[model samples]
Target: MQLIIMRHGEAGRHSLDHERELTEVGRKQAANVAEKIAQSDSKPSVIWCSPYIRARQTAAIVGDILGVPVKEKSFITPDDDPGRCLDALLENKESPLMLVSHMPLVGSLTTLLSDGHRNGMPFMTAQAVVLDMPVVGPDCATLKTQFLP
Candidate 1:
């Protein structure tokens, strides 16, 4: 399985954290990353993203570019537990899966999948980490490369 863990594009402040929307620069960043993915062999077959506005938007951009479908997942929010999120991901049997989410979760989940720990990697907005996993579990994934936009 190939896992593409992506941090949502930069977002403007909102009264409600869940309602935060991507800024203009964020949209460009998303598109740029999507273009990079489309040109590479790592394009995802499906996208799973946090239900938050910014994450949804980021996923939509990538999905549109790749001509894949996007699904909103409630468990991938910024503060959601990485282990629980991994459990939720295991329910789906899709290869080349892309997940769009926020800072802490995206980082922590990447580390959990690749290192068997939640020490957490760091990600910039609109950045993506690609992992190759034989199975979807802790320490099962190998960090392939990262796409920066």
Candidate 2:
């Protein structure tokens, strides 16, 4: 299976963390990444996104460009456990899955899957890392490439 782990675009600060919205620059960043993905062979069958506004917005852009369905996964939230998120992803049968989420979770998930360790990667806003995995487990995936916008 191929997994694309993406961090949400830059967001404006809000009193409610979940309510923070993407900035104009963030939208442009998402658009740039979406265009890049659309030109690639790695189209996602399904997209999973955090419920947070910024992540959802980013996922929407990708899903629209890729013509894939997007679903909100609570486990992909910023502070959620990477192990649990991995387990949830493993439950899906879809290949070429995409996940739009926040930092720490995005970076940690990539590290947990690629290097068998958490916090091994630090992702910038609007960055994505692709992983090819035969099965879901620690260190089971190889990094294909990273896309940054």
Candidate 3:
């Protein structure tokens, strides 16, 4: 299974954290990323987003381009654990999972996925982190990638 960790694009600097929508540039960034993903062989089976407006908008833009549906998942909230969020995705049957969320957590999740991530994980705006998970047991799994996007 592949996990696509996506960060919401540039948001309004003056807007509240919970309500900020993507800036014009952010919208373009989202579209470009979406188009790039649509051209990929590893298409996302599910697109999950944080309930935050910016994240939701970003997810919707990508979802539309990829013809994949988008939904707000609470587990991906800013306060939620990135590891648990990733775990929830692994439990899902979706092969290529896309998650749109904020920072700190994206970096945190990337660390959890990469174990040590000694090289550091900094996902640029609208950047992607493609992750591969190998099945360890019927209900268990392990990440096996150091690739970036």
TM-score of model number 2:
0.97
Ranking by TM-score: 2, 1, 3
lDDT of 1 at 48: 93
Q: What TM value does model 1 have?
A: 0.97
Candidate 1: segments with Cα more than 4 A from true spot: none
Pairs clashing in candidate 3? none
What is the model-wide C-alpha lDDT for candidate 2? 0.90
Q: Candidate 1: minimum summed lDDT over ten consecutive residues — where?
A: 84-93
After the best TM-score superposition of candidate 3, give how far the Cα of residue 126 lies from its true spot, in angstroms.
0.6
Estimate, for each residue in 53-106, the C-alpha lDDT of model 3 and write its tens digit. 999999989898899989789888666776677668656887788889988777
Better of 1 and 2 by lDDT: 1
Which 10-residue span in candidate 3 carries the lowest summed lDDT? 136-145
lDDT of each: 0.92, 0.90, 0.76
lDDT of 1 by residue, 3-91 (tens): 99999998998659999999999999999999999999998889999999999999999899889999998889999999888887688
